[model samples]
Target: MNDGTQVHLRLVRPDDKKLLEQGLARMSPESRYFRFFSAKDRLTHAELAYLTELDGENHLAIGAARYLEDGTELGLGIARFIRLRERPEVAEAAITVIDEAQGLGLGKLLLTMLVLAARERGITRFQCDFLARNKGMHTLIERIADDVRYGHESGVMQAEFALEGPEGLYRALAGVARKEGHVRPGSGLPKLETTNDS
Candidate 1:
């Protein structure tokens, strides 16, 4: 069990479907809209199945889990990239953190891990879509990704960015605090920590 503030990052598993659902339930309606781009309150059976299934290379996902003293686990955040079949080198990335965990640097940490994971599988470009009002996310993308380009359509903002080489990624990781959390379930990327001051 963690000390409540500690978040354990690991590869997503099929069994995490329930935890993910619970995390969604805890989100505010606004938060839900921010992540899903709609007022979606529930995950359909098909949606759950799709979210839980991961192929590592094409549909890779990582979860940030917080454990209580009683051995209960809660899904604090998730970051994933799904490679397009038509463009194997490109992937769309998405991340969502529970409201309780927001502003604690969890989203940044998860995104950093996702970038490393995607680069490991030969993914070169990452795309993301969000509402134009979500300035926090925009700032985050600007901070981490290189060669970023933005597009706007009907109030929605889309960003595409290229992943940097190993040296840059390693430098970013090294700048973070190593004691905050650990990315696990096996990672080929450098093991640098991201600040998680929760």
Candidate 2:
């Protein structure tokens, strides 16, 4: 066994296929169920590829958390960014975490790291689309983001959090997005309900 504990956050390499599989296998069934909405014990090869892919337009960024000393793998957290082709200034964020690591603030860490990377790539806002049934996502969004918008029509709630300046300002700007869900955010955040938006 690799006994992965200490790890560095880095881009997933194509060579890390086995490591990725091992990490996913280590997740509790419940975590896997929530993260993937399935009870299956493993990720399909295609799914794994999609989860780790890092294309500029449609990319997957995984932050592998580990114990720093021994390079042992502790857990893996994922952040995915999708660019809006029609409106190049916009993008979206999707995330998932392994069960054992959910409450350890790794979600925030993964989100921060990914959002920063998105900013580096010129993405100003990070938005989410998750099952309304997932309260965890709602809590996560409400805590770190400005505010959340709930869509009653399809059970889809999308949260918008700015990735700029101070975290407080981000939240406040997010608050504006909450109100402006009916309007376009001055800089970049798109309307929440449009399928054309993303």
Q: What is the overall TM-score of model 1 with all chains considered together? A: 0.86
Report the number of the highest-TM-score candidate: 1
lDDT of each: 0.79, 0.58
lDDT, candidate 2, 6-115, per-residue tens: 33345554555676687778788766655665577777788777666556445646454555358554546655678777755567777677776667665664565566
Per-candidate TM-scores read 0.86, 0.67
Backbone clashes in model 2: 9
The true-versus-predicted C-alpha distance at residue 121 of model 1, in Å, is 0.3
Model 1, residue 85: distance off in Å is 1.5
Question: How big is the positional error of residue 39 in model 1, measured in Å on the Cα after superposition?
Answer: 0.8
* Model 1 stretches astray by more than 4 angstroms: 1-4, 165-168, 171-181, 184-198
Model 1 lDDT tens row, 90-132: 9999989888888787788888878877776898899999899
Error of 2 at 59 (Å): 1.1
Q: Please name the candidate that would achieve the greatest lDDT relative to the true structure.
A: 1
Go through the candidates in order and give the clash count of each. Answer: 0, 9
